[model samples]
Target: MSVFGGMSKGERNRIKIRVRTAMATQTQVEGRYLGGLATPGDGSPLIDAYRRH
Candidate 1:
């Protein structure tokens, strides 16, 4: 049973686009954090990522 079975192709494409956009934004933010190039406000995720061992 697929959740998307009732959705139109365009709806599916829009969902995919939104998810891709979110993932790209996340990658950019995380890249900044991991590279130690992030500004002061973006501290929590950077700390968590560094502390994850």
Candidate 2:
């Protein structure tokens, strides 16, 4: 059986909520960096390249 198989429904929901929040925060940070790189005359295409991912 899986490690989390015995967890209650509430426990599982809490874990899922925490994970989703963390992922959202990470994505926001990445998007902020991409926006900074996208500024006029910055001349770095790295952000644009990552934006496609």
Candidate 3:
């Protein structure tokens, strides 16, 4: 079964949007600063992305 099988269409769509936005932001940051992609030595991507301000 699909992972989203139990979710409503709207819920799944919202998740897609969030994932896309996160992925785009991650790619942009990685390219501009981290040299195109996340490296193992760079540490956690999620933690770097959602840092406290």
Q: What TM-score goes with each of the models?
A: 0.43, 0.43, 0.44
Residue-level lDDT tens digits of model 1 in 1-53: 36566567769899999987887788788763324345467465344556657
What 10-residue stretch in candidate 2 is worst by lDDT? 31-40
Error of 1 at 40 (Å): 27
Residue-by-residue lDDT tens digits, candidate 3, 1-53: 56567567769899999987887898788753534555567584444656677
How well does candidate 1 match the true structure in TM-score terms? 0.43
Off by over 4 Å in 1: 1-7, 32-53
Candidate 1 residue pairs in backbone clash: none
Best by TM-score, which number? 3
Candidate 3: worst-modelled 10 consecutive residues by lDDT = 31-40
- Residue 47 in model 1: lDDT: 47
How far is each candidate from the true structure, as Cα RMSD in Å? 9.1, 8.4, 10.0
Model 3 alpha-carbon drift over 4 Å, by segment? 1-7, 32-53
Assess each prediction's global lDDT (C-alpha) against the native: 0.67, 0.66, 0.70
C-alpha positional error of residue 43 in candidate 1 after TM-score superposition, expressed in Å: 29
Q: Assess candidate 3 and give its lDDT.
A: 0.70
lDDT of 2 by residue, 1-53 (tens): 56557567669899999987887787788653323334457664444554645
Backbone clashes under 3 angstroms, per model: 0, 0, 0
